[model samples]
Target: MNATTQDIEQLGINTVRVLSADAVQKANSGHPGTPMGIAPIGHVLWAHTMNYNPKNPEWPNRDRFILSAGHACMLQYSYLYLTGYDISLDDIKNFRQLHSKAAGHPEYGLVDGVDVTTGPLGQGFANGVGFAIAQKHLAARYNKAGFNLFDYKIYAICSDGDIMEGVTAEAASLAGHLRLGNMIYFYDDNHISIEGDTSLAFDEDVAKRFEAYGWHVQTVADGNDLKALTEAVKNAKEETERPSLIKVRTHIGFGSPNKVDKASAHGSPLGADEVKLVKKNFGFDPEQSFVVPDEVLNYYRGKGDEGVRLEQKWNELYQSYKEKYPELWTEYDLERTGKLPDGWKDKLPVFDPAEGKVATRKASGKVLNAIADSLPGLIGGSADLAPSTDTNLDKYTSFTKDDRSGRNFHFGIREHAMGAALNGIALTKGLIPYGATFLIFSEYMRPPIRLAAIMKVRPIFIYTHDSIGLGEDGTTHQPVEQLISLRSIPNLMVIRPADANETAQAWRVAIEHKDGPVAIVLTRQSIPVIDQSKFAKAIELEKGAYILSDSEKEPDIILIGTGSEVALLIDAQARLKEESIAARVISMPSWELFEKQDAAYKEKVFPKAMKKRLAVEAGSVLGWHKYVTDEGDTIGMTTFGESAPAEDLYKEFGFTTDNVVSRAKALINR
Candidate 1:
C-alpha cells in the first residue's frame, strides 16, 4: 500500500471512529470504547481481508463476519455505512432508534451485511466458528480440482469479555477439534469491561488456553500497526491446518484524550467538549462531529466500484465453471436457493397411527430418515445424544473436517458447541441443519439458540424428553420452564406437537421456514395420536391451538393442553360428558402460533365470554396466565420432580385423568 493509500485507509478507519463516537454521543447512552478501539481492525478486515459484495450482501460464497463483542455495534454500523452497503449516514445518525437499521446490537436480517445477530457475549465467537465449518462443508461437497466452488473465510472480532465467557471456550474448543483453518478471530485486548479492568475476574492466558485446545495463536503488540495487523492476518490465512487467533492489544478509546484506557470510556460517550478536544488532538475540526473529508468519502465510495468488478470476475469464473461442469453447476444452483429435491419428502416414513404406540423420539428418527433421502442438504447430528435422541439417520456418514459430504455430525457431549456449529451450518447457504438433545438440556444450548433467533437462521432443534413425563430419570431430566423460556425468545418457534401427524406438520413448518429457528419439543413417553377422523383436523395445529374435540354444542368448559397432555384432556373430556358436562378439548402445540391466529378464531377456540377453562401441562404454569381467566386453574408443576417410572410419576404428580377432571369441575363451579 502506498502512503496515500495508507492515509485513505486511516481516513476510513477514523471516519468510523468519529461517526460511532458522534452517534453514541448524540444518543447520550451507548458504548464507545470498543468502537474506537476496534475501528482499525474492522477497517483492515472489511476493506482488505474479507471477500464480500456490498451490493449483494446475501452472496452465498461471501466471507462471514461477526462482531462477537456486539456492544461495539458502532464498529459494524460505521463499516456498513462507509463500505457502500444499503445503510445511509442518516441511518447511523439515528442509531439505537426504533426501527433504525443500526440497532443497539447487530441483528441479522435487520442489517444488510451483518452475518449474524450478536448481543450476548461469546455467541458471535461460536457463530464465527459455525460459519467456518459451513464453508469447509460446502467446499468439500462442491469444489473440484479446477472448481473452487466454496472458499470463504469466517472472521470475527471478539473482546476480553467474549473470551472470558464459558460459551466462547466451548465454541473455541470445538473449532480447534474440527481443524477449521478457514476461521480467523481477532481478540480486542482492551483489558477493560463495565467493571474496570477484566483482570479482576479474568486473568487467565487466553492464547495459552486456545493453544491448549489446538489452535494457532498469534499476538500483535500494537493495535494501530496496520502492517503488523495485515501480516498477522496473512499468517493466519497461511495456516491451513488449524484455526488462528490473533490477539490485538489495543488501548480502549485509543485517540480519546481524557478517557483512553478508563472504565468510563468503555460504555459512555465522551462529553461534547471532551469529544471536541479529542478531535483536535487527532488533527480534525474540534467543533465538527461525524465530518467526513471529501477525499475520505471518495476513497471509500470507490470501494463499491471495486466490489462490482470483483463480483464480475467471480461471475466470469463461475461461467467457466458452469461450462466445465454442468452437473455440479446445477447442484450448486439448487443448493443456493435452499430447495429440496422433488422426491426428498417422499421417503419421510409415515408410521400407521394404529401401529402400537411409539415414543415421539423414535418416531422422529423415522421422519428424519424419510426427509434425508429426498433432501441432500439436510445435515446435522446431536450433542452426543443422537442414539438416545433418535436423531441420527441410518446409512448416513459422519461429517469431519476432511469429509464434509456426510449427513451426520458427531458433536460429542458439547451442547453449546453443537448449537453454535448448527448456526454455522445454517449460515452456510444451501444447508438445512438440525441439532438434538433432551429438552431439559436446552439450558446448555440456550446461548446458541438465542443467537439463532437473533440471526433468524432456520436451525431446527430436536428436543425430546419435553416434560415431567420423561420420568425415572428424575426432576433433573424434566423441562418445566423450557417451553416458556424458549417461547420468550423472539423469532424462535417452539412447537410441541401432540401426535404423529402433528409431528409431521411441525417438521413441515420447520422445513419451510426460511427465517428464524424452530424447536420441535417431543416426548420420551408415547402420546396417543388424536384420531383426525373423529376429532378436528390435524391441519388445525397450524393455527397453533385448535379444538381437537368439541362438544355437540358450545361447550360449558374448555380443557387446554399441549404435547402429551392433550391425551389427558381427551380422556377427561370423556369422563365429563358421562356426567352431562359439556367440555371441549383444545391441543395447543405452539403459543406463538396460536397468538398469530385472528382474534375471532382465538375467541372461537377459547371464547372470551367463557370463564370455565383448565390448562393442564406437566411444566411450569408461568405462561398460562393469559389463557386462563377468572377462576380458571392450571395443573402443572412448580417444583422439580422425583425419579420414578413415567406412568407412576404422572399419576403421583397430579397429571392424571382425575386431576384434570377435578380441575375442570372446579373451573366450572367458579
Candidate 2:
C-alpha cells in the first residue's frame, strides 16, 4: 500500500516534534512544550506557506520568518535542518551549547535562516513591523510597471508571552495604523505560561483587541489542523490592506500525556520515560531518536525545491527590470550591497566657527538633509519629537500609507516599538534606518538597542537633550545617567560630539560604521563651534578621543570633556594660560571607538605620566575614572538636576570654566 501526501506530511510534522523533545531531553534544558505544540505551524510555514530558498538564505526577495517566541527555537532549528538550510542535525542536537549555531534563542547572524535575534518576547513582533515597512517602501520604490521585486511579506509566530509584552502592544498599534498589509503573524494561543494556565493572570478578548488595532483577525481552533493553518495563512495573504493575525489555540506539550496543557513542560525537558511515550504515541520507534524518515526528508526538500523555481522566475523578472530601468537598478543595487554612491560623503556639511553658536541637534538636522539625496537608503524619523530631536529630512515627503517612497518617517511616540522596528528595518538589505527621542527616554529603547548590538546590526539612534541642557523640562526630563548607561552596553558606540563640526563628523562615522549600533548624543542648547584653523580639524573626531588644544610644552594637567563640556574645558585651557598654567584639553567623544585603537595610541592620548587630570560631562561621573585615573577628579552631575535654565543648571551642577579650572588646580595639588 502506498502512503498518501497527507500521511507523509503528518509524519514530517511529528518527526520535528520528536526531534525537538529528544534534543531538550539530551541537553537537559530548553522549553519542550512550545516546540512540540507548534511543529505543525512550523511545518505549514516552511513547507507550504512561505517563499524561501534554502540554497540561498540571503536571497533579498525571500519571505522572512521570525520566531517571536524565541524560547521555542528548537521548532525553528528542526525545520531549518529538514528544509536543507546550512544548519545541520548535529547543530540541532547541540542546542543551547556555547558557540553552537543553535543558540538558546534564534540569533540572526549565528544561524543561516534566523532573520533577527529574538529572545525578549515582543521585540521580534515589533521587528516584524519594521520588516513590513521595509517591504512596502522597497516595493513602492523599486517595483516597476512589469516587476514586483519587493512584494515579499514578513511573518512571525508570536506566543501569549509576546502578546503580554508592552513592546508588542506598541508595535501592533503602529502596524495597524500603518496598514502594513505585507505583515502576517501567527499568535500561538497556548493558554499555559510558566506559572499555569493563562487564566491565572490573563483572560482578555485578544482577537477583539487586534480588531480594534485595525488588523484583520482569524482563529484556527486546533494547532494540529494543518488544513486550517494553511487556510488561515491564505486568508492572511489575501488581506492586502491591513496586517493580519491568526490566533491558533494549541495544547502545550501536546504529546506528553501527563504534561499536556500543563506548565511543567513550558521551560524544562520532558523526563526520559515521557519522551519514550511521546515517540511511541507518534508511531515512531521508541528506541531510535532524531529519526527523520527518508520520505519525510524528500517531502520537505521537495518544498525547498519549490522556492528554487520561484526564485528563478524572479531572477528573470529582475534581469528585465535591470535593463528597462538602468538608473533605478543602480540605486537598488547600491541599497542591496549597503554601499554608498560615489562621492556621497562629499555632500556632508562642514561648519565654520564664524557661524556663531549652533546646537549639535541643529547641526545634525543639517547633516541629515545635506546627504539625504546622496544616500537613498538613509531613512528615519523621531518618535513624535522631530522638532525637538531635529531628526526630520527636509527635502523628502513623509512616509505614510499614501506614499512609501518618502525618506522621512514619523515613528509617533512609540520609542519601544520604534527601536524594535528599526532593528527589523536594519535587517532588510539596502536600508539604513534611524530613530530618535530624548536621551532620558532611552530607557524605553534599551532592550532593542541591546538586541541590535547582539545582532551587530546598524541602526543609528539619535538621542538629543543629551544632558541637563534641555533644562526647563526639569529633573524628570534631564538625563544624568543615560550616557554612562548607554556606554555600558557592549558593542554599542556612544558618541557625544562637542560642536557642529564634530556633529557633522559623527554623522560621517555613523554612516561608515559597519559593525554594531551607534548612538549620537546631541545637545538641546547652543554650543560654540571650535575654530578648526586654531586647533585640530574636526575629522579627528573619528579617533574617538583627540587633543583639541595642546600646550607648547608637556602639559602640567590634562582637561577631558565630551559634548558641551568640551567648550568649558577649552575655556579653562585659555584661563589656565593666563594663570601661567599649562593645560591641554582633550575631546573624548566615544570610548568604544577609542578602545578599538592600539595600546600605543591609547597611551599616547593618556600618558601614565599625566596623573593630574580633570574630566567634565553633564551626565554621570561614574565611568570617568577609567580616563581620569585615581589621582584625577571629574566635574559632573553627582545628583539629579533641577528645573532651572541650562546655564543656571550648569552653574548649579558645577559644569563651568571656573569650576573646571578650580578642579584642575585641586587635581594638580593632589
TM values, all candidates: 0.94, 0.99
Backbone clash pairs for candidate 1 read: 130-424, 344-374, 347-370, 348-370, 456-516
Residue 423 lDDT (model 2): 95
lDDT of 2 by residue, 1-670 (tens): 1459889988988898899899999889999999999999998899888999999899889999999999999999998888889998888888888899998899998988899998998999999999999999998889877788988999999999999999988999999998899998999999999999999889999999999999999999999998899999999999999999999999989988788899999999999999999999999899988788999988888888889888999899888998999899989888788788899889989888897999999999999999998998999998999999888888888989889888888888999999999999999999999999999999999999999999999999999999898989998999999999999999999999999989989999999999999999999999999887887544578889988899988999999999999999989999999988999889999998899999998888899998888989998999999998888898888899899898998888888888888888877877
TM-score of model 2 vs. true structure: 0.99
lDDT (Cα, tens digit) per residue for candidate 1, span 491-570 = 89999888877888788778887779999999998877667777745557678998889999778888899888988999
Ten-residue region with minimum lDDT total, candidate 2: 532-541
Residue pairs whose backbone atoms clash in candidate 2: 335-430
Per-residue error for 433 in candidate 2, Å, reads: 0.5
lDDT of 2 at 472: 90
Note each model's CA RMSD in angstroms: 2.2, 1.2
lDDT (CA) per prediction: 0.85, 0.92
Question: Top model by lDDT, which number?
Answer: 2
